[model samples]
Target: MILFGRVRMLLLRTIAYLIDSFILFILVIAGFQSFLLITGLHPFIGRHLYSISGNELHIWLFASIIIPVYMYFVTMFNTRAQATLGMRAARLQINTTGRIGIGGAMLRALIMLVPWELTHIALSYPKPFWVAHHLQSPLLYIALSLTGIYWLLPLLNLHGKSIHDFITGTIIIRWHMPPTKKP
Candidate 1:
């Protein structure tokens, strides 16, 4: 396992994140559409989702969208590959003593979801509602701040470990296999 420098790791991780985000976006859209179909809701039906005053259906729908995403990370990270699709594309792997256990993988996934979940909450509040509720500003600020810190934490460490990595005792490394000999 070859450890990457901070800059290289950052670049690779960023690209991996972009790739993962695109894939997750597609998955989320499909899941949402499926949920609508199963519930007999029209695809074109308009609903006000940009509000904190959403109904239970909205909450359930959001959970349906989120659970699969969380599972995607947890399952992928704990697998023998120890890498997501984007990570595989970038030749990066999660370095651990052995395989990262399910608990560690799940913790890492939850930690990684912090900023995203917070941002989702903050953004769900409409402008007027956010203005009326001063707490929304602080929540948004916290989400943005945490996101920046999470992304930059690796730069502060020699081993390029981020917050989630440190919390879960994992490291990201460049993975290379020896070239196969031709008979």
Candidate 2:
């Protein structure tokens, strides 16, 4: 049975996410180091190798980071576990019958990706760059707003389904153990 209330669910999910994030951070660092080694470039040498101002390079960098993460989520969600490592640690499962298809998994992964990528971009990129490039204020504002909403939406829903859950037609449910009788 599903055990956790919204608060517990949220807390568990947060813990799980932190654990997963830490793991991914390590992977990202390793990947960066590998890239540097393979290309024989100093850490600061390839400053322009993938500039944010260049569309192709920007897309490539985004894709390079996103694709592996996307595959990780999709593969885990589609597995018998039906949960990522974080979800498993939280004792949360994707409440669905049968396996979530590749398309569904991809959609869910992408939905989760948007807010994450947007917030990273908003925080990492300078405002002056956007202004100079005519990207305008609303874009950053929207990204920030959406990032806020993405987290808060779970609280608004009866079942604690976030925006991504709703968009991907997925639900998160917690596992519960039956009570034991005192001897």
Candidate 3:
């Protein structure tokens, strides 16, 4: 049996996002471990290759690379693959709410994962360039500075929507489940 467009679309999007968050949580843990070893820093599991209180060079490098990379990875994969690990596991689809194609998903993903926000990633420490370039306003920061404005769109608009949602026509939702639908 078929469900309403709203029901199916909403559920699907939610499932997809949940799957994405769950899988990426693992990726964050596992990826960062590899990130530490490759960069020659010590994970908390060990004594020390060095700590943050030291030169903090690793801090900068990690910030410059890791944060944006994680965002890019999640968005790009979510868009291009047409499904993230969570989405796939939950058996949901994306762009269905927007009723868009895989191509549209990819385009939307790329736009949201702009490269500049990486600058503010360093600000996470507020102490040092140890893991990143200075929060010196890279290209993404400008967009992010504008994010407050965009975020307000969701609040201001009647339906709680954002500019990106308007632009990509994308949103999160829960996928429908099937019952017997028997007579």
Candidate 4:
């Protein structure tokens, strides 16, 4: 029974994450297009944007993904809902043992960004760098390991709390809405 419940929760969480990711992707694309148009570079946008490399690519990734993701998580986590759209859809809520102020939420968001930023760093390097390093990408290895640890910690905890939760003193739990009184 416990195992089944765990699996169900896992599936819900995965679906929620996918939905959130899709939303973010759409927002990023729209923002990118809008930027190009506003800057009068629409004509040079589409295919050329795909060929961006080096510092330009880094800037784009940081601006479009990192900052937006950080802000999204921080805002969602700190709100009355205490969950992102994904978590809410999955019937999950963030609960802190003690009061977690804006600083706590921001720290949690920053810690959550570690694996993502590390993976980006590993992948953003030039192809030649990987080849020269004999394909032994330390950053990639570390990022993957950390990602696994972050995810696996939830399974180890009875409350479904992850590493980020431990660090920030927050936990994710099933949300139950209060019943309304009949008028």
Candidate 5:
């Protein structure tokens, strides 16, 4: 049956998502730092950032974003990753009626990157030229902002769907795994 009250489901789904996103953040950085270094750049924390490669940075950043999307999609679409490492840890999963799509997954990741959304103002894309000298290009911050709009799904969607999920036709459902029947 299609769901009517999406709040509970949305909360569960979001919690699961946070778990996966957190894990993906750690794993992707640990896995890809060396690759970023291969491009003759390294990630460092400081007041003044280093590197001039916007394209390289974009690529690395995209990798970081895409991993979680893929992981989330797998769980949302196939309902497997839902119970995987992150979701299991958080006790969350996909909805029975909701599902994930490739486009939706990508859209969700893209949107989540947006910053300063609570101000209810459009974010201006900063055109920092120095990034190009380091082997990078202008980033699609707007795209991320557009994608970040997904956060409003639970709030905006009476049925509990973010723009990405709405576009993908996926809904967050409170997941409860029934006991398996032994054959």
Candidate 6:
């Protein structure tokens, strides 16, 4: 029964993450479209921003995605509910051993994003000049391994805690909101 609960929690977490990722994807597309419109309207801004090397473009794109996602995680975790929209949808909450302040939330968010960002780097080919600077690229293997380990971590434990949760001394658990009082 305990193992089953853990498995269910892990599945819920996975679904929650997918939901959040989808939301972020939409937001990123909308943001880029907005930027394109602004740039199209003003050639000067477009010229300055658009004029970048291929490698630099990749970095900029990554930053654009990472920055927003990082901020979202940090903000959501630091909130009273300590859950993102997806987490809420999945009825999940963060249970922290200590006060998980802004700094802790930031660290947790960054750690959680590491495997994902690494996978992106590994998959994006023609190897951005900086990435392919080395004679041999071990990034793909590292990325795949890390991603698999991170994703499988919850299964190894009963509480469904992943690498980020362990690193930050936090746990993700099923939760429910209390009933509101009548006016």
Per-model TM-score, in order, reads 0.81, 0.74, 0.46, 0.79, 0.53, 0.80
In TM-score terms, candidate 6 sits at: 0.80
Write down the TM-score for model 3: 0.46
Ranking by lDDT: 1, 6, 4, 2, 3, 5
The residue-by-residue lDDT of candidate 6 on 66-106, one tens digit each, is: 78788999999999888889999999989887668898899
| Tens digits of lDDT, candidate 2, 149-173 | 8777777767888787898777888
Best by TM-score: 1
Model 6 score (lDDT): 0.78
TM-score of model 4 vs. true structure: 0.79
Between candidates 2 and 6, the one scoring higher on lDDT is: 6
> What are the C-alpha RMSDs, in order, of all predicted structures?
3.8, 4.9, 7.6, 3.7, 7.3, 4.3
Candidate achieving higher TM-score, 4 or 5: 4
> In model 3, what lDDT does residue 160 have?
45
Q: lDDT tens digits, residues 59-134, model 1?
A: 5435765677788899989989899888899889899999898998899999998887776566554443433463
Q: What is the clash count of model 1?
A: 0
What are the clashing pairs of model 4? Answer: none
- Residue-wise C-alpha lDDT for candidate 4, range 67-154, written one tens digit per residue: 9888988888888878889899888877887556788889988998899988776766653232335246788899989988876766
Model 1, 125: alpha-carbon shift in Å? 5.0
What does the lDDT read for residue 81 in candidate 6? Answer: 83
Q: lDDT, candidate 4, residue 133?
A: 50
Model 1 is weakest, by summed lDDT over 10 consecutive residues, at 49-58
Candidate closer to the true structure by TM-score (higher is better), 5 or 6: 6
